[model samples]
Target: MRLALTSDNIAGACEAVVAEMIKAAQGEAMPYGGDPLTEQVTKMFAELFECDVAVFLVSTGTAANVLSLAALTPPWGSVLCHPESHIVNDECSAPEFYTNGARLVGVAGEEAKISVSALEQAINKRMGDVHSVQPSAVSLSQVTEIGSVYSLAELQEISQLAHSKGLKVHMDGARFANALVSLGCTPAQMTWQSGIDIVSFGATKNGAMAAEAIVVFDKNLAQKLALLRKRGGHLHSKMRLLSAQMLGYLSDDVWLNNARHANAMMALLQKGMASIAGVEIIAPAQANMLFCRLPVGMAEALLAQGFSFYTGRWEEGVVRFVTSFQTQQADVEDFIACARDLSTSHTKTS
Candidate 1:
């Protein structure tokens, strides 16, 4: 079997999502988010968060993220985020384009998470400077790029600081469910309760086909964001399809269950990798994603065995393994066994 640990979205749609999509296809309904399914999805999200929220469905996380940022910031404003944040490193400047040239200021921090002090410094750096972009918002990634999840206290501290500085807080929740399950907190507690103004609630990475939500906690931004989403050409006409995926993802706690399973698989992988000689865990594996360094030969051996993962993105020997709802335990065990064998052979040969 070719084991793939590349990313969750690569695993394809989950069974429930497929079923929901089929059901959606069988019925004709209103378009442009005027359908009942879309309305239900909005209510479902509001219920999930334990507060009234405006949920706008989009086909991609990038759309969800950039539109949310655009709603929070102005052309002359900037968004403060960690240097390794998806908006800064992975989005290919879509944020800048959506915000009409708003700057993304990278704040230095460890493990892909922005510390309150670092964010404060970044925000204060250009305050009232006409030559510099004013910090208007702060973006945080739940289950950060390096797999480190911010504690509720950490989130609260950062949100409080940003709000005190007149900055809106946005969460790029591409792995929201994973981080939520890891933190063992309610969705509301992780977001609005922590002072987050908006969230790019991602389902594609978790289990859905291509459903991502721009969940607005700050009701004031909802109308403006709806307009921005349309202007950005992200408002899907067959919106029920997107809404159905979210409906299925949320039904019977499928989202949470999927995240728990993925996290469990990652914990098993982390444990196995820890025992392999010359493998170094480079970050805190708090969610389904893990970053580690492997001996070149061991990595090559694993690849030879048809096990696939990301490598050399962060550094020379560092690799990333992302577990998904569909990741099989057997594949994980096989990978570990192969790595152990390779490590042993290399040690003996040397």
Candidate 2:
């Protein structure tokens, strides 16, 4: 059984992107994002988002998030995020560093989606107290750390609440396409129409090689972000390679197709795991990831049998299985079989 916890390891850049990169390497293009392909993808994103969006291409998701947040918040202001959000848990205070000491306050929520009431309370918790970090932004992770995505209604409620409180909304969309395919909503509905002010539109985690974008809905933020990206050393001189990958990713709805396949594989794995005697689906298997608890020792046994995955990374007593466009049906079934065999043997002994 073969499984990978991160998209970087599961599959390489899609074939389309590989071909584009090779083509880009053989040709001459303008440096520092002046190439035609870079300009074209920017237009493509605006069309897809159904609005005029300022798009900045970057090599990493962390840079995308930090730069976007830096543009929106000041050193003393705070950005709200779910406890398990990638910004809060994984980014190593880069948001604070990029924003020059801005704080990241955790908002409580169920299934990794921040709750509205908790967010409102947090926003106003230290409203005028100079001692506390004033809430200036709310960062949401689409297809959250535990794989649950906020529904369209849920996103709208949170965004509206944040905007009403004079706070901007940002989405860490590392798995943007996966969440989009899962929700079956248009890009505008999920972000700007729902009041999101900015997005770190991540394509690297899906199928692109080191391509991520910072998409700004607010023109004011976009203006500041341009300087920040260049000053922060994220601006690539040979930028067409990144642009080409994004172009390949978005063309003909390839991103949506890849997401659909990954989600379907997760659904298959989640369903089969649920039927096993000693397995527990720990979180909502909403997208291309699953968080489940196996019979004690089952995880170790499965690993011994050649399955590679993430266990106890997010929490103890649970394992994470991430499916990508490259995951095959046979791998899913074989994994399920391995778990069942261990569960059955453990049950008989007990």
Query: What are the Cα lDDT values of the candidates?
Result: 0.92, 0.88
Q: Which stretches of candidate 2 lie over 4 Å from their true place?
A: 5-9
Clash-forming residue pairs, model 1: none
RMSD values, in order shown? 0.8, 1.2
Q: Per-residue lDDT for 281-338 in model 2, tens only?
A: 9996789888888888998888888888887665667888888888888888888887
Clashing residue pairs in all predictions, respectively, total: 0, 0
Error of 1 at 346 (Å): 0.7
Model 1 root-mean-square deviation: 0.8
What TM-score, over all chains together, does every model reach?
A: 0.99, 0.97
Window of ten residues with lowest summed lDDT in model 1: 296-305
Model 2 residue 318 distance off true place after TM-score fit, in angstroms: 0.9
lDDT of 1 by residue, 9-117 (tens): 7888899999999999996898999999999999999999999999999999999999999999999999999989999988999999999999999887888889778
> Model 1 reaches what TM-score against the true structure?
0.99
C-alpha positional error of residue 61 in candidate 1 after TM-score superposition, expressed in Å: 0.5
